[model samples]
Target: MSWNRRSLDRPTRRIALAGALFCGLTSAGCIVIDDAEARDEAEEVREDLRDAADDIAESITDALEEIGEHMSDFAEELGGETLVDQPIHFREFYDFLPERAGNLRRTSREGATGGALGFHMSVAEAEYEGRSGAEVEVSIADIGAMPVIGSEGFVEWLDLSVDEESDRGWARTIEYEGYPAMEEFRRTRGDRGRAEFTWFVESRFVVVLDARDVTIDELHELRDAIDTDALADLRDREGR
Candidate 1:
C-alpha cells in the first residue's frame, strides 16, 4: 500500500516550519544559545518529526493492507470464478429471457461483452412491447467475465429491509423466488406509470425489469414471467 501524500505532507510542512522558526530565531539573535546546544536541539526535533511521520505512514499502510485482503476475500465469495474463471459470452444469457412476459412481447434482443477498471462483465438486453408498443426493457448482466462498462456500479441490495410509500407510488424489498429483490413503482395518469424490479441472483447475475405505462401488478407479472432459477443455474454450472 502507498501512503497518502496529503496526510504525510501536511506534517512535513509543519516540521519545515519548525526548522524555519529555529533559523529565524538564531539569525535575529532573539535568544542567546551555544551553537552546539542549538544544533543538538534542532537534530532532536527533526528526528522526532521523522519518527512521527514514519509511525503515521506505517499505521495507514497496515490498515490499507488489511482492507485490501478483506475485500479480496469478499469479492471471491461474492462472485467466485465469475470474477476470474472464464471468458463468458453474452450469448449464454440470450435464451434465459422470456419471449413473452405478461402482455408484452419481446421486440428485440441483444448481448455484448467488454472490460473496464480491471474488471470484465457480460450483458444480455431485450426490449419488450405491449399491444400499444410501450417502452419495456429487460437487462440481465453476468459480471463474471466481460468488460465492466458501467455495470460495475450496480450493486446487490443485501439484507436491506425497506418499505416506503409516497403520493407517487411505493417501493419495497422482498425475497422474490427466494432471491434478494427490490421493486419500485411510480404512479402516473390513471393506472399507467413507471416501474422497476431488480433481482440480485446468485451474487453474480443482476437482472433488471424496467417499464413505463405499467402498474405495480403489471411489474409483478413481468417479474413472475422470467425463470430466474434458469439464469442462476446457467451461471453456477458454467462458473464451476
Candidate 2:
C-alpha cells in the first residue's frame, strides 16, 4: 500500500513540474495555461501586427505617389511636352516670308511634310535682280517634334567654328532681332556660292534660309524680315 501511494505521488509531482515549466516559458502571469484565453490573446497580437504592416504599406504608397507628382510637375515646367508635341502649321511660317528680299523676287513657294520624321518645311525660290538664271532658295523647317534638334543642346551645336580656310566654310554666331542665330557662307569655285542663316524661334521651331548666288548682306536682310513677335504669339496660343 505505501509503494502504490509513492508511485501516484511521483506521477502527480511530474505533472505539476511540466505545468510550471510551461508557465515560466510563457511569462504571461500563467494566463496562457488556459486554452481559450491563450487563443484570444494570440488573435489580438496577430490583429495588431497586421494593422502595423498595413500602415507601413500605406505610407510607402503615399511617398511614391508624391514623388511621381513632383516629377510630372518638373517635366511640365521644363516645357518638354508642350514644345515637342505641338503640331507645326506650315502656312503661318510661310506667310512670315517676305514677298521680296532686296532686289530678289519670289519665283516659287511650296510646303513640304516630313511624315514619320516629324518635321514641316516651307520652301521659297527667288531670282536675283539683273543676274539671269541665278536663283536662291529659302527654307524654314519646324523640327520641334524631334528631341535632339529641339533640345537645349541644339543651341550649343549651332555654335560652329568660323574658318574660311576649312571645307565647312565660314560659320559664325550672330543675333537676329534679339534671337541667337548662325550664319554660314561658302564658295566652292568661280562665281557659284551658297549662304545660310539658321536660328531657333521661341526655342522650338528651326528657321533656315539657304541662298544660292546671294551675298552675306542680302541674307542678313532676309533674316531680319521675319516677324519674330508674331511667331512668339503663335507658340503661346498653341501652348495654352
TM-scores of the candidates in the order shown: 0.58, 0.51
Candidates' C-alpha lDDT = 0.59, 0.50
lDDT of 1 by residue, 1-240 (tens): 001122222322333244344444444433345799887787666666666655644443343333334334445445433344442566777787778877878877755454333344555667777844356777676655422212332243266577999888878888877877777788776677887888777666777777888766666776788888787776544432
Q: Per-prediction RMSD in angstroms? A: 20.1, 34.3
Cα deviation of 162, candidate 2, in Å: 4.4
Q: Ten consecutive residues with minimal summed lDDT in candidate 2?
A: 1-10
| TM match of model 1 to true structure | 0.58
Distance (Å) between predicted and true CA of 228, model 1?
A: 1.0
RMSD of 1: 20.1
